[model samples]
Target: MSITLYALDGCPFCVKVHDALEANEIEYETVWTEAMHSDRNEVKRVSGQRGVPVLVDEDRGVTMAESEKILEYIDQTLAQ
Candidate 1:
């Protein structure tokens, strides 16, 4: 998939990002991370930080973290 979302289960922030993508009808692959922050090595490697709700859009050459920023990005760029 061109877009990949790194998220943790039961995270509200992560849910927000996921909802944005879904609302926009964007297709993305999801990588569910471990509940413990220390186990989120893949998230850190991809996003430079182990934060839930990390978005990686290879097509846009974008990788970012934070729920609000990700939501903004989706609205500004990804939203149709």
Candidate 2:
């Protein structure tokens, strides 16, 4: 399964999500929203909003916004 996290460097929520993923030992690619302007637009297009800590699970075909929910979903899905 491939997981990707879209975030900005200085966002507190983004940091929380990153820490959560690390704590859970979940492997994922981090896409910095500020650095990837084009991809950021794509994320907004798909999610219908511009938000930090957007998590995409490619294998499950799930994309979600919000840090707390993403953490919970990851924990539930990846915790075995």
Candidate 3:
């Protein structure tokens, strides 16, 4: 399974999501929107918003917006 997190470095919501992932020991690839121009558009296209902390799971073909919701979903989905 390939897990990707699209986020901007300075976003507090993104930081919270990151912290949640780390606390739960979830392995994921991070795509920084500020650093990667293409990722910004991709995130916007996928989530219909330019906000940070979008989570994408390629294996499951799932993309989610909202940091708090994403964290909860991740925790529930990967908790096994």
lDDT of candidate 2? Answer: 0.82
Two-way lDDT contest, 2 vs 3, winner: 3
lDDT of each residue in 11-68, candidate 1, tens digit only: 9999999999998899999999999999999999998888789999999899999999
Segments of candidate 1 deviating more than 4 angstroms: none
Stretches > 4 Å off in candidate 3: 35-39
lDDT of 2 by residue, 1-80 (tens): 69888889889999988998888888899988865555579668757777777988888989899988987887788755
Query: Could you tell me the TM-score of candidate 2?
Result: 0.83
The segments of candidate 2 whose C-alpha lies over 4 angstroms from its true place after superposition are: 35-39
lDDT of 3 at 14: 92
Scored by CA lDDT, what does every candidate get?
0.94, 0.82, 0.83
